[model samples]
Target: MLKLLALCLLTSLMYVQIAEAGIRYYKWEVKYEYKSPDCYKKLAITINGRTPGPTILAQKGDTVIVEVKNSLMLENLAIHWHGIRQIGSPWGDGTEGVTQCPIFPGDSFKYEFKVDN
Candidate 1:
C-alpha cells in the first residue's frame, strides 16, 4: 500500500510539471453587445460580452488553444490571431473563410496555434 501511494504521488507531480511547462488554453464566447466604449452606446462585437475580450498571455514555444463559441443570432463569427505568427500550424493563420470556414451562430470553433518568436 505504501509503495502504491508513492507511485501515485510521483505521477501527479509529473503531470503538474508537464502542464506548467506549456499548453495554455482559453475559452471565449463571441456575441453582439451594445455598450459605450468611447462614451457612446453602439452595437459591437465582443468576446464574452466584453469589448476587448480576453487576452492571451503565453510565452514562445508554448501551445495555445482558444475555443470560441459564436452566440450571435444572425451573424457568423471568425477570429484572427492578428500579429502572432504561427510556426507550424498554417491552417490557423487567421484567414477568414480559410481556417475551416467561419463559425456559424450557435456553433463552436477551436483555434489552436503555437507561439513563435
Candidate 2:
C-alpha cells in the first residue's frame, strides 16, 4: 500500500512538471456584439475588450500560446499579433481567415509561436 501511494504521488508530480514545460498562455476577451448582419468585431479593432485589445507582455525567444475564447454568438473570428517580427512564423500573427479563423462562441483556439530576438 505504501509503495503504491508513493508511486502515485511521484507520477502526479512528474505529470505537472512536464505539462508546465514549453507552454505559455495569453487570454483575450471577446464581446458577443454585432454591428451588421455579417461583420463582427475584430481583435485589433477592439481595445482590451473595448476598442483596442490589451498588449500582451512576452520575452523574446519565449514560446507564446494565445488562447482566444469567444463569448459572443457570432461565428468566424480571428486575432493578429500585429508588427511582431517572428521570422516568418505565421501562427503568431493573429490574422483571422488568413492564419486561423476566429473561435466561435464558447469555443477556443490556441495560437502558438516562439519569439525571436
TM-scores vs. true structure, each candidate: 0.74, 0.54
Query: Which prediction has the highest TM-score against the true structure?
Result: 1
lDDT of 1: 0.83
Which stretches of model 2 miss by more than 4 angstroms?
1-24, 32-50, 86-92
For candidate 2, write residues 7-105 as lDDT tens digits: 999999999765654546777767643233237543333423554466666666567777777766665567766666656567546666666566767
The whole-model lDDT of each prediction reads 0.83, 0.65
